[model samples]
Target chain A: MSPRPETAAGPAQGRPRVKRFARAEHRVHRATAALMAVCVATAACLYLPFLAQLVGRRALMVTLHEWSGILLPVPLLLGLASRALRADLTRLNRFGPHDRRWLRSVLRRRGGRPAGKFNAGQKLYAAWLAGAVLVMTGTGLLMWFTHLAPLVWRTGATFVHDWLALSLLIVIGGHIWMAYRDPESRAGLRTGSVDAAWARREHPLWTPEDGKGGRGEEE
Target chain B: MTKDENPARPAGHDDDRRGTPVGRRVVLGMLAAGAAGVAAAPYLQRAYDETLGAAAQNDPTGLSGLLPAGGGFRYYSVTGSVPDKDEHSYRLTVDGLVRHRASYRLADLRALPQTRLVRDVQCVTGWRVPHTAFEGVRLATLLDAAGVRPEAKAVRFTCFDGAYSESLTLEQARRHDVLIALRMQDRPLGHDHGGPVRLYVAPMYFYKSAKWLSGITVTDHVQPGYWEQLGYDVDAWVGRSNGRDDVPTT
Candidate 1:
């Protein structure tokens, strides 16, 4: 595929735009984010003594936290029906030579190597979070259904669930901080599109000529 | 208060026993050995109850209560450490809207015909210890002995644990399954399990089974318990109230 010119102009500003995320991708991201927010907020209310006392609807909080966590994977699973999302997920799964270079540059605090649709850091975060969520769900189910396992297993599940949840909260905070630092990435997530210039500058290797970029032409 | 009073001992026996330290090394050793099979050793469970569980009871933050101890039950106290009540000092009082107000010591309670129930203990927060055995005098038996007045519609339970109370309608209180649980898991209830006595409401969530039970007062209406006052359902029936659907413990 050759690098194609952006056809759809940005809303109001009229800057040329390229599709960075599919509608399914955007919706999945948003749904997951919303559920994650509920989980974190309810977890805080349940775990923090001051918060638990201040917001004393603990039963409600427990229900909300459990259901939100159980439902966290639904959006991504449903989004897999979309070919665009599936393709993006494949791209996220693979780490090329450029990704290793990008990681090295990140560690060195220097300019990053040319990147594709997702950078090495983004890939690692996505992969780590997916594993964390899966482990949490397994451990959470064990904690909830205490009879399904022995006492030691249940105790261990609770231990892992509590600690992993704390780590998830911290990692999510960093994810939000990074997202806040990058307006283009945040806008792409919000609107399913990005300025063609921003895409070319930040993810040069993702341009259509490389065959791994998001839709270079506006969809 | 009772015909069986022993005048030799002081009344404040429970007060004197609060915060009595258990040997930490002995408890730690048992904990390590018990880690292999916690459910198998009742003595280890008792050691944990007297040490870590007792210490946790005094923790104002209640975080330590979340630590997995006492076999399966979590340690929860609304107030700091509860005073220890033993066979000699422990007394259960039955009053309020009753024809015969009475006080019974541990022996008096144990002398009554005992009922043993094996049922799942379910917590509203979603933990279940299945097929657990609790043996004690029936709450109904006590209510009947007290001769509840016609106007009395409910029974309020008070705990020596301090700041914890629970209530059940007279009908619910009289259920054959409801017990003034003196023994759990085929052993005399440990301190951490709300011994020397506790209420075991078999059909309801575990919170309804108030621990360290000391007083039973027949009342005119349902008074919300400690957790209920903090927004837990007053009628915390398993698989029914609290928006939960766990298999009924009954």
Candidate 2:
């Protein structure tokens, strides 16, 4: 069999057109992440009281808490409803043999490309967060509008909302650290594109140069 | 829960980070957070003073608004957006049962008649804001307008958010004092207090005060909304239900 085209440099043409996400898609994702963080922080501010001795203003904390609820979810809804994100998510969620090979190399320190367009961890995080945001919206709506249910339902939803928020926060804390600490990961989000070298180094399998991806423009 | 084998303890938070050793940043960071928390204590105390402090003053009617001594209304919105509508554009609809099927804008209702009642606004969550001023269209007035049917046993209420739904027993809906509130403390409902129109049941826990209320459907029998189906007492009267033996709702 012939060697793969990706294993070699681009065929004498100019730099291949990069498969960059649209500007709006990047804007929405970053906005949602920031808003979600605000919501979690405000929620912590309000919950700290019941968890311990009161830590902040009940009214002020409550006021901030309420606004955060409205503020945080707007960006998420904007992102989810976007046609671009929905499509990008489909590719991001897929798992394939290339993914497995990448995993082994990671485990063994053997020298093939890093797994798939994204390692399993990144895919799992994206999918799980999507589900989490959806759940939070549903349960949160039930809570804010207590009259929609009998008294018991409202109370229970409130309890669940708080617990889920706490758990999500712990996970999100790690996500932020990973994105910020890893220079390559943060670059993709900051500029709707990543340096070819950076992409090859972190997600070698995803690099168009690999020609591993059968799908048109993106590898 | 896991125990912290080496929990960081701080002393009064007076230390300044000048030429602090880089190696001790983690400990210093913890100290900073603790100090900030202490700094926020006064605001928490102030909020309690505004709420429970008012309740302690002179809530004779045992209503849900702030006492005269407390100085303001401070009902909380977990998500914080309440309609707080003005009289000119406000509207309340009663549908889902009977033949009359009508919609009354804020003006039409205000013109019909008004009733005022003051009662305690106790929350199942534990805090009680007392003697709140509630005034508006009594349930009896609206129920009469729609003309309840023999088959109807409950009324389902939906809000602007489109997710929350609440139900009221036919009997409860007809209570002479049960109201669809237009005003609280002589002013229109504000954003924080379930503005525009919220249910004002003087004798029940505060959850019954559904904020941003939009739709009302008369049903054959009691079908609990989000909360009731989950397990909160359908008849959440203060101290009367919800398995808690705390102060009475009224």
TM-score of chain A in every predicted structure: 0.89, 0.71
Stretches of candidate 2 exceeding 4 Å from the true structure? A1-219, B1-89
Expressed as tens digits, the lDDT of each residue in B123-239 for candidate 2 is: 766555667788888877778778888888898887764456677898887887688888888888665567777888777777777877777788998888655665678887777
Residue A93 error, candidate 2, Å: 45
Off by over 4 Å in 1: A1-11, A208-219, B1-97, B100-250
Docking class of 2: incorrect
- Two-chain DockQ for model 1: 0.01
TM-scores for all candidates: the values are 0.54, 0.43
Instruction: List per-prediction Cα lDDT, in the order shown.
Output: 0.74, 0.60
RMSD of 1: 21.2
Report the lDDT of model 1 for residue B14: 17
| Top candidate, metric lDDT | 1
Native-referenced DockQ of model 2: 0.02
